[model samples]
Target: MVVNTGLYAFNVTCAHRQITPTVNSIYGDATPPNTPADFEIKVASPSFTRRFFRPQVSFYCDQHSPFKPLPLAQAYALLEWGMNWCIATHDHTRLLVHAAVLVKNNQAIIFPAAPGSGKSTLTAYLAMSGWNLYSDEMAIIDLESGFVSPLYRPVCLKNNSIDLVKQWFPESVFTSTWKDTHKGDVAHLKASSWKQYIQCKPTEIVAVIFPKFVANSDLKIYSLDQLQAFETLSKNAFNYGVLGNLGFKMVDKIIKRAALFEIEFGELCDVQAFLSEDIIR
Candidate 1:
């Protein structure tokens, strides 16, 4: 199947009916049959099906799956992760940063952080609360324009944030929870409207905020210098080393143009207020 992820297209082939529906449910907008696939996935059920104690499924990228088979229930999450891996590894046209992007009125903010940094949780909240989600995992930076493109997919909510997001926005579309993965208890909040994604032009980044969620703490924002921001972003980018000078130029340009900050936030309302009053003008 050829799935067009708005910005990029992927070709996936999976024989399992149990898994296709799940992918379809999350990425139905992209799955239009018979086009060229950017990345091909072929997943197969374990041959040891005779031992029905725990059925498993294996995910293959270009007919090769590096990881071991996972439980049948985790097939969809595996495919999602596989697709993201294929993009990060193969696509080099854009400088990819490990960040969450949110846009409002053609201005965007990039939230770059490490694992367990509450980036995805904040992204899920911003996305559901009147902000357009560019991506939950990647900030695709265009070299020529110095603008970030929207991935326009799901906001992956892991751990407790999954239910927190559900409670905050009951009207949202979410996938079934896949438990015990590398990331604990993962679920994806489908974009509130895929319509917002279709005609997405690259939006200039206004601020690059590194967020760390601290429990029971007040919102704290710290300014980062240009050199500091450059170094920080360079470290967070997946393809920076491979892109060479082009990557450095892009990162430098972004650092020069966008305001840089590191924020430790606890309350969602406080963060939202800060964005509205200070950043999103």
Candidate 2:
């Protein structure tokens, strides 16, 4: 099947026996039919029953099954999200931290946290309000330029967050909840528009926020020093060690330009207001 993403075109073919998705670029003269001049993506597999591949830097998902038929929408969403990860890991050589990105006033703010850290919940709320959503899973940074690239993929809401976000933003667009997967009870929010993906731009890193959700604690924002922030950010990186010295320099440059903080909050509205007043404006 062929998917047109405006900026790039992708062709996905499933294998009859494999479990992983492999990509084969069909650039130049080997481009697929109706391929855009800007980018062409061709994926082939010889081992599965279903597959998905995303050519855009923001997202892609490819999977193979023996007996089960995967939903097309779900497969596309997965490929899109996965492709974002693939691009960040392959192109930038910078650390791909698990986090959510929100942009305001042309500056990008990243929330890096472990699972159950309320990152997605916070991101969903911010997206519904006014902030532009970059991603909810991967933080893509350009290694050479020290800029944050946009990954306009869906925000994966897990467990209780599904109900929490539903109650908070009742009009939000959420994919059907999938059960018993990697992250217990997972649902996705397609909050960003396709225009956001095509017009994706790299922005300066303004703030690094490590958020922790405390049900009863008052919203507290702690100032984090460069060393502490760098250490934590490195730990969250997907390819820090892989990129070596270049990665270190890139991370240092980002830290020098951005203020780092650790936030503890329970209310999304309060957090949003605080970030708007303190960080963005």
lDDT for each candidate structure: 0.85, 0.67
lDDT of 2 at 265: 97
Runs in model 1 lying further than 4 Å from the true structure: 31-35, 46-53
Query: Per-residue lDDT of 1-281 in model 1, one digit per residue for the tens?
Result: 66667766777777567877777777786536344566777666756671265878777887677778888888888878877888888889999999999988789999999999999989888887888889999999998999999875788889999898899888888999999998889998886566777657789999999999999999999999999999999999999999999999999999999989999999988888899889988
Which pairs clash in model 1?
Answer: 11-37, 11-38
Q: lDDT at 44 for candidate 2?
A: 35
Winning model by lDDT: 1
Clash count for candidate 1 is 2
Worst 10 residues of 1 by lDDT: 29-38
Top-TM-score structure, candidate number: 1
The true-versus-predicted C-alpha distance at residue 201 of model 1, in Å, is 1.5
